[model samples]
Target: MHLDPFELHRPTSVDEAVRLAGELAGRFDFLAGGTDLLPNYKMHINLKPHLVALDRVSELAGHSLSRLGAMERLSRLEQDPAFVAAYPGLADALADLATPLVRASGTVGGNLLLETRCFFFNQSYFWRASLGFCLKADGDRCHVVPQKERCYATFSGDLAPPLLTLGATVEVAGPGGRRKVPLEKLYDTEGDGIRRLRLAPGELVVAVDLPDGAAGQRARYKKLRVRPSFDFPELGVAVAGRWNSAQVDELKVAVGGVETYPRRFDELTEALVGGPLSDAKVASLAEEITRRLRPVHNTFLAPDYRRRMIGIYVRRAILEAREGQGG
Candidate 1:
């Protein structure tokens, strides 16, 4: 498969990029890493007439302990000792993302905004035509859930769960202006996979900001996928918190790959806080996660198996965090 013809625009500034996006409107798409977008384009998944490449924008490139520019390559960030030490769980997710070559081309922002995937939607044009297109791309009905109104394509990003657990916020620039929101807010909870992100037209993510205290927290990321070498996550769990002796403090848990968005379990966090990190509590938290998630048959794994693994992965992530804290 090959990429469809499109006009490519290289904008040197954020303002210029926003202007291009605004002018093009629904006919355009932002190009950051192109690791995800280009492949989808090649498969004729979603074809836009204009590509606004952010490569020339200098403002989107840099990284510190607390601030990560969206344009920074995943491979670079994963190999950086200081960055790895600062955000170990995020580094772990990055390392487990794709192969080194794909990571080299994938950026933090791209991963954060990776497209939702489904077995039926991500096929060749002929294959999709043969089966009738799904809601995400050309058709209206969702094959995953066989619903007219909702698309059940699964969220497959590996970075979002860890970043959400770390309390990261993203800076976005658009025609309106710049604003920051919690990383979790970037996703549209009520929207289907066809319209998943909350980003407005002409908006571009500038950077991701992590709290200084986030670096000191104990965290772990557990991922389940069919292939260890490289494949989208079937299920992923990320946990972060401070261990006050044997008790939990200010905990955050985020789950992904089994839902339409990476979700932070505020209810579970509230239940676990100020309590001892015991097996019973962990098991209960995992059970709650399993109860909350409803995985559809969009990925390679079976829905029931993925739902069951949610509890297992959550338990393992929390336990690993506790063990990492030397508890």
Candidate 2:
């Protein structure tokens, strides 16, 4: 696979980037670490005419415990022991994404705004041409679900779940100016999966802000993938909560790699917050989540297997997070 030539635009500031995006409109894609986009480009997936490189954008560079820049590389975050220790669940996700080499070039924004994946969508040009394409690409129908109304491509990103557990929010910039949106609302599952994120036409993610309370929570992330070193997750589960003497104070459970979006079970998790999360309760929670998710046969794992593992992984993540506090 080889990257076809395209016009590369480097913006020194956020304003410049936004201007460039407005000028280019639908003909451009923002280039972060290029770990994911480059590969797709090599396979001649969605070839945009212009590439907006964010490397020189000063507004999208920097990282602290409270805020992580959109352009921050995963390798940089993993190298910081304090950052990793503060959010162990996020650390697990960071490590689990691709491999060391890919992580070296994978940025937080790239991962958060990752493209939806499907078996029929992520193939070479010749393969997709032979199959007549899918809803996410050049065709009118979804190959995964055999439908024309909605795309069933899975949201395979791992960062969103752990970040949602931490109550993270994202800073976005557009022609209308900057605004903040909760990370949980970032992925729009209700809409046609082809649209994916909730961002406007010219908007771009600037950074992700972490809440002060998220720093001390007992958090854990568990991912199921075909290959540990390099492969997208078939299922990723994350749990974060504050425990007090066998009772739950605040709890958030998020799962990705199973559906169109990485979702938080706020209704289910909120119901058990004031009470204790016993083994039986945890098992029920797991079963309910397993029942709710709709995994398609897109990735390496079967829909049934992925659905079954949801209960197991969710239970394990919640239990391990609870055990972390030893109560």
Candidate 3:
């Protein structure tokens, strides 16, 4: 498939980019890495009339130990010794994401805001047309769940789970002003896959900020996919916490690629914070996570299998984190 013609605007600064986006409104899409958006465009899914390319925006490319610019390349972060050492779980997720060539061009912001995928939504134009279209693109109803008011497309990103577990925040700029919100808040749990993100019109993600002490936490990311080489995650579980001599001091768990958004188990984490890291506790936590998540038949994997793997992966990730802590 080939890309349909559209005007591309290269904005030099964030202010200029926001202004252009505000003017273009519903007709434009922000181009950072184009690793995800360009392919979707080729499939004729959510095609925009204009494109605001952010490659020339110098401010969006900055990175440090604590703050990572949204436009920072995935491959750059994966290969950087200091970055990898500081955030091993994040580094692992990046390493497991797509192939090296795609990772070299995939941006952190793009991955965080990756589009929800489904068997019906991500298809060639003719293939979708034969099925009368789906809710995400040209049609009005959802084919996956056959719902008139909801879409069941799955969020297939790998970076979000680990970042959420790390308690990262994101800086966003728009016509109103700049503001920072917890990275988990970026997703709209109340909305369907067609309208998943909570970001307003013309808003751009500036940077992702990790708290000062986040790097010191013991963390692990476990992913399950059809192929180990370069496939989108079927199930991803990320766990992070500090251990106090075989006991949990602090804890956070986030799971992705199951539903409309990446979700964190606050209650489970709070309950386990002061408890001992025993096999029984880990098994209970895993069982609760499996009960809470409801993976549908949108991806290549079966719903029941994916749902079961969530518990297994979560259990394995927590144990791995515990082992890393030498507890």
What C-alpha lDDT values do all the predictions have? Answer: 0.88, 0.91, 0.90
Q: Check candidate 1 and list the clashing pairs.
A: none
Arranged by TM-score, best first? 3, 2, 1
Q: Runs in model 1 with CA error above 4 Å?
A: 325-327
Residue 35 lDDT, candidate 3, scale 0-100: 90
User: Which portions of model 3 show Cα errors greater than 4 Å?
Assistant: 325-327
Candidate 1: C-alpha lDDT: 0.88
Output the better candidate (1/3) by TM-score. 3
Model 2 C-alpha lDDT versus the unseen true structure: 0.91
Model 1 clashes, total count: 0
Error of 2 at 162 (Å): 0.2
List TM-score per model, in order. Answer: 0.97, 0.98, 0.98
Q: What is the lDDT of residue 308 in candidate 3?
A: 89
RMSD of 2: 1.3
